[model samples]
Target: MTLPYGRDDDSAAYHYINAALRGRDAEAWRLLAADSHVEQTDRVLRAMLDRIAVARTHRTAERATARARAAAGEITQAEYQRDAAEDATKASKTAHFETLLREHHRQIAQAARRLRGDDVRDELTDLVLALGAAVDAHRSAVLAAGYEPTPADEALWARLGELDVPDTDEGRTSVEDLVRRHAERQDDLGRVLAGIILDVAGAATSVPRSALLTEWKKTVAPTLAPEQKTEFAAKGKGSLATERLRKTMGHLERKGLVKRSPDGQRLDLLDRAGLADVADGRE
Candidate 1:
């Protein structure tokens, strides 16, 4: 079977070339360096470009000649039309290949630059007084962006608390600490959610959705209290506790205390310590 060549083949070749360079393959690296004589790779590129230019000029002339011959009755119109159609097909294929090459050229340039890591540096001075202007700018940007932490984002941030690595304020209130604390500051229900999620954690990263709902009914159903059940009887059929659980989990997710598993049927507990802090009470 004849294997077709297309974008997949081109992409594989591009990746292979860049990976070879980044992996320090000596021969692949030579493309960037040249001997004192002639730049070998540059010459090869220029030669290919020159050939393409010549071919383009030839193609224009060839089409014009075919049209002229057909008009002068030197060749039959049907024959000329068939040849023209074939030429058009070839031209389209060539055009697509050229476009792919141009894209490869751009991405390869970027990949090469990143591979070199041209100007990395260590700390220039003792930044004991502050994190320096650049670090300060980044922190300010994070603040300015008005980031609203979602459950996934919060989960990641909460997990970072394990590091307890503070960047600002000199070893106090690591960003992760602030995130865990945010859980406490929200509402009474959030602490309640934290306790429930903590109870669900085990060898598994998460528990099924049904597991959480069942647990919710046991923990917070108004029927548990005589007065509570009577008050909610006319409230409607929707489970207020379940709605609260959804909102509470949403809050927990942002706190990074828990996350929904990719299947979304289970909720994963991310930062156990953060959840512990919440469940112990700050409400």
Candidate 2:
């Protein structure tokens, strides 16, 4: 041990002793702070444990009182039996109603499938292809007949090539008029065919991507196990099948065949007529 420093002396031994004491003092201070934190944490944990114990005791007392009341003449056994029976009846009725609702939904979906028969999509594809061929032929004939294609006619042809059908009422009317006038120049039969084509294309467009996916899920989900369905609903890694769906959607989007929701959580089909045309070899 080193002696304490003299009042006037600045010795090396004094400095060395002071430094050594500082190192030990810092270690002691750290240990004291850690102890203080541990004590505070222990107190908080004890308080929480006490609250839990009190709650458990209160619940136990309540159950004991209820049992005593039932044992006495206050709550009769017949009343208890009646209450239990009523609960059971309500549960049974609720289950039966749920079964009926599921059946109703299944029947409705089946009816919708029958209405949109297996060949409906194929027939729509043929119609789109035929319409596109007629339009292209008419455009060529305009040049052959010594009439330059007007700006409107040129624009309409461009829109057709891009499969950019307008969804609004005014735009639909304009396209109908454009097709009617252009087709009539070829023959009366051409006008009738154009109208039928428009009707088919409109019907096809009415079936949104959500409706298609819902029908697909209804058809396929029953075949999948519970785990498979959960995997399908999950995002990111570990589900190759789910990832494939995402990839296919991405590919369609790149080809301008589909559009995504604002949040990118949903996808919607656009320009079904254009898709049909492409499927039928018009692309």
Note the Cα lDDT for every prediction shown: 0.56, 0.45
lDDT minimum window of 10 residues, candidate 2: 36-45
Q: For this target, which candidate reaches the highest TM-score against the unseen true structure?
A: 1
**lDDT (tens digit, per residue) of candidate 2 on 1-283:** 2224332343433343235334544443232224223222222223333444455456557656655777896888786566557755765765564344333323332333334452354355446645765777678789789898999879857755466333223553333344545344323322222233334336543333454344444433444454333322322234443343444455445557657677765555575555555444454
lDDT of candidate 1 over 180-229, digit per residue (tens): 44434455677766777767766666777777888887877743433233
Per-model TM against the reference:
0.31, 0.21
Model 1 — which ten-residue stretch has the worst lDDT?
118-127
- Model 2: how far residue 157 lies from native, Å: 40
Clash counts per candidate, in order, are 4, 0
- Evaluate model 2: give its TM-score: 0.21
